[model samples]
Target: MSRSTPRPEPFVSATSAAALNDLRTRLRATRWPDSPADAGWSLGVDVGYLHELVDYWADEFDWAAQESALSRHPRFRVEIGDLNIHFVHARAVSPVGPALPLVLSHGWPDSFWRYSKVVSLLTDPGAHGADPADAFDVIVPDMPGYGYSDRPTGPPLNSIDVAGLWAELMRILGYSRYGAAGGDIGSAVSRYLALDNPESVVAVHRMDAGLPVFTGDRADLSPQEQEFLDSSAAWGSTEGAYAAMHRTKPQTAAVGLTDSPAGLAAWIVEKLRGWTDCDGVIERSFSKDEILTNITLYWLTGTIGSSMRMYNANGSIPSEQHARRVEVPSGFSFFSGDLFARPPRAWLDRVANVVRIKELPRGGHFAPFVEPELYAQELRDFFRPYRKALG
Candidate 1:
C-alpha cells in the first residue's frame, strides 16, 4: 500500500436495535395513500402493492439476515481524498495464473448491494462451474454518498470526480492496472475512468451509453442515431420525473424519502419494478426481502439526499465531456429490458473504441443483480482476451 493513502480497515454491516425498532415503528404508522379503482402502477408505485410490501417490511423482512449476508463478503472502508469510501474487496481464489484486478461501480436506487451476487462468482469462477483462469480480484465500491460510505459535505461528486476517486482507490490497493465496469452513473464513471486514466484502466465495460447528448451538427448523425436520440427524449418525458426531481429539487424530494420508510420504499421499488425484467411482477425479479433490504439501507443511511444531489452535479458536466470519444478498449452488454438496451452500433462506435457488444435475451437495467450468473459470464467472456494481452 502507498504511504500517502491510508490503510483500509475491515468493516461489518451492523445496525443498532434502536434503529431497527424505529424502522418498524415508521413502517407500521405509514399514512396510506388512496389510488383510483384498478390503478395498478398507472400512477407512481401502486398503493395496493406498497401496502403489502410495507406490511412485509414492518413485520416480516429480516435486516439482520441481510446485513449478515452483506458482511459475508470481505468488506473495507478507506479514506481516499476527503471521503471515507466503503468497498467490498474479494480477491480471486484458486487462480490458474495471475488474476486481473477489476473494479465494479454501482448506480443509483442501489449501492454495493447491486454487485453482491456477482462478487463471489467473479472472484471464484471455478467454484461456480467456470474456468479458474477467468478469476478476477473484484472491488465493489459504494459511490461516496450511498450505502455505508461517507457522504460528501460540499457539492455532490459527479461521475468524473467519482472516476478519479476510483483510480486513486485502485492505486492505494496497489493495482497498477485494472479493468472498470458499471451501469447507470457507474457507466458514466467508468467511461470517464477510461477517458481520463486510460493508462491505468486497461479496458472498460458499460451497460448503456447513457441518455444521448450531441453538440455536433444534426446533419452529421445517421437516421438511426437521430431516432435513438428522439426515443431517449421520449423516455425522459414519460419515465424521467424521478430523475428530474433528483437533478432539480433533490432536497425537496429527499425530505419525504429520508423521513418515511414507506416513501423511501415507494421511490426505490417503483424503479425496481419498472426497470427489471419482471414483466410487471416485481416479486418475479426481486423478493420482498431483496427489495426491502435495499430500501432500508437508504432509510438508515439518510444519504438519499446526497445521492440524489449527484444528479444535480452531473447535470452541470460540460458539453465537451459528453462529446469526448474514448480510445480505451470498450465492451457493452445490452440486456433485453434495460433502458434503450440496443443502442445503435453507430452511436457506440462514435463514442468508444468499440471492441465487443452483446445483447442478452433477458435481464434489465440492474443486470448484475437480476441475472448474476449471466452477468458474471458476460464479464468473463468480454475480458478474457484482454486478460491474455495483460500477460
Candidate 2:
C-alpha cells in the first residue's frame, strides 16, 4: 500500500471545546440505573460511582486544568488516510544526547493522558534527574477515533494501517529513522510500525503481545504450555464478552453506552476492574476519577462505537492468529496479567528479532498507568542498547 503524508491540524479547535461542554450537560441529565454490582465500581461503575464522579467532573475535576496540562506540550493534528490524527509532539532538549523520535500509542480506554507521566521522563530526563543520554524526542498520539481525533467518518481502520501512518508522521517531523513502544492495542501498532514500515523504524519495544501461535505437532506435551493454555481458556470463557461484542455487533450496542453516563461508566468500568494488575479490583490500582476520565473521553467523543470498529473491520482475527509475520528487531516485557498472549520465545523469534525479554515483578493490561516505575524502567533498559543510534 502507498503511504500518504499527513496534512496539518491542531490539537483542539472550537469544535472539541463545544463537545466537552455538551458532555457535561449530558452527564447532568443522566438518569442512573439500578446497578447490578455492589456499592463501588467493582461489579461495574455502580450508580454511586457515576453520581460521585459526575458530580466532581461537573464541579471540581476541572476540564480547564486538564486542558491546560495537555496544552503545555506541542499539540497538532495530521490528516492520515482521510482521518485527522491528534498527537502531542515534544523534542528532547539535550544537544549532546541521542534523540530518537519515539512514537508512543495508547490502547483502548486510554487517551494520551496515560503517557503524560512518562513523557517528561523520556524527553526531559535530565530535568527529572535521569541520564541525559537516555533522552528521546517523544510523540504520543490518540488513535483515530479516541480523544481529540476526528471521529471515524465511515469504515473501520486496522492496527497495521495506523502504524504505517505513524512512520509517515515521523518522516514529516524530519526523522528518517525512529523507534516505537506500545501496550495492548499500542503493542499491535508498534508491531506494524516495525514490520510494515521497516525503512523508517529502527527498533520496536512491546509492553504487551497478543495470543501466540501454538504450533505443536503433539497436543499434550509440556506442562508449562498446557498450564498457560488452560488458564487462557478459562479467561476466554468469563472475560471475553467484550471481545465478542466488538467483533460482531458494535454499532448496535452503542446506543445504551452513549445515552446514559451510568451505562457508559459500567460498560467501560468492567474492563478497568477485570483487566488491571491489582489483586482485588481496578480501584486498587486506579482511582474513581482515573477510571471515569477514560470513560468521559469516550462519552464526550462518542468514540466507543467507532473505536470498536477495529474488531468489526477485521472480523474475528482468530486469537493467536498472525495476520503478518513481523521480522523487525523487538524487545518484549511480559507482565503478570490476565489475557496477555504469553508468546513463546520461539514464535516471537520467528516473527521478530527478539533482542530482549523481561518478566516484570508486577503489572497488567494497563501497564504504564498501573506500574509506571516498572513499565518505564523496562522501556529504559530495552531501548538502552539503541541509544547510540537513536537517542
Candidate 3:
C-alpha cells in the first residue's frame, strides 16, 4: 500500500428498490416485436422465448437473492487513475505453499459476474477437492465503464490502457509478481500486461488470439493463418453485427438497450445462447435466473453503452501494437465449443511464446461460468509450475 494509492473501500451489490420497481414496470410494459412464422432463433433472439423470459423477469425473478449471492465474496471499489475500479479480492483460504496471485479480466456482455462461480473454486481449491498448494489469491475486476465501476467520461480505455491500470492495481495491493488470465477483451488485456510489464507478470493465459490483423505483407502469411483470417471474416459477416454496432454506432443501439429492459435482455441474451456450448437450448447452459441476473446488472448500472464504446476505443490501437509478440511464457486454451474457428497453433506461435495449449473437451466462450470446476482445474494446472517462479 503506497501513500499515493487510495484505499479500497468495501463494496456490495445492491440496487435501489425504486430501480428494481422501474425495471419490473418496464419489463411488464414492454411492447412486443413480431417475428416471421416459426422464426425460432434464426432471426436474432427468439420472440416467443423472449416473451416467456420477460414474463418471468417481471413476475418471478429475484434480484435480491442474486445481489446477495454476488456480495458473498469480498468486494471493494478503489480509485485507479481516472476510474473508480470495482473488483473481488478473494485470498487463498488455506495454502500449502506460497499462493499465486491471479488477476482475471472479463469480456463484453458480461462483467465480473463472468467469474463469480469460479472465485471460490480458485481461492479455496482445497474445499473443492483440489490441492490447497494450487490455491490462488484471485482478483477479478469489473472493467471501467462496466458493472459498479465508474464509467469513462472521456475516450474509452483500450486493452493496453487497462493493462497498465491492472499493473498499478496489483502494485497497490502489495503484489510484486502475479499471473494474468482472461477471455474475450480480457485476453487482450492480459497479453498486454505481459507485454508491457514483463518482469512483474509471471505468466499469461488467454483463450483466444483475438481477430487476426495482418500488419505485414499478405505474401508472408502461412496457409493456416490465412485460413483463420478468412474464417474470422466469414464469422464477422454473419455473427458480428452487434460488435460492428458497438464499434461504429453504439450510441444508437445503446439508446434502446439502456431504456427497454426487454431490448437489453434480447440484445444480451441472444449472445448468451449463441456463444455458449448449449446446443441450441440456452437453458441447458444457463437458467433463466442466471441469464436475467447478468442482464439486470447491465440495466441497473446503465453500462451497456459505455461497455460498447470500448470496442470503438480498441479499434484505434495501432497496428504495430496488435502485431507485437509477447515473449513472456504464454498459455492458450481453445475450448471445443468456442468461436467455431479456433486459432491455429501457427497463429498462436506467431503471436506469443506459446508453452501450453489445451483443446478443452467441452465449454465455450464463457468457460468460467459454464464450467467452473473444469475452468478452475485448468488454471491450477497451468499456473502450478509458475508458482516456483513466484519465490
Question: What is the lDDT for 312 in model 2?
Answer: 75
Residue ranges of candidate 3 with Cα displaced over 4 Å: none
Q: Which stretches of model 2 miss by more than 4 angstroms?
A: 1-10, 13-25, 35-48, 213-223, 281-283, 316-323, 337-341
Give the clash count for each candidate.
0, 3, 0
Q: Model 3, residue 187: what's the lDDT?
A: 93
Candidate 2 CA-lDDT value: 0.73
lDDT of 2 by residue, 243-344 (tens): 778878888777777777667776777777667668755678887667766777777677888887776765544445353666667899888764565756
Worst 10 residues of 3 by lDDT: 212-221
- Would you list the clashing residue pairs of candidate 3? none
For candidate 3, write residues 1-391 as lDDT tens digits. Answer: 5587789999987678999999999999999987999999999999999999999999999999999999989999989887899999999998998999999999989999999999999999999899999999999999998999999999989999999999988988889999999999999999999999999999999888888888677668888888888999999999999999999998999999999999999999999999988899999989999999999999999999999999999998999999899999999888877875888888889999999998898789999999989989989999999999888
Clashing pairs for model 2 are: 9-77, 98-391, 99-391
lDDT of each: 0.92, 0.73, 0.92
TM-score for predicted model 2 compared with the true structure: 0.87
Which pairs of residues collide in candidate 1? none
Best by lDDT: 3
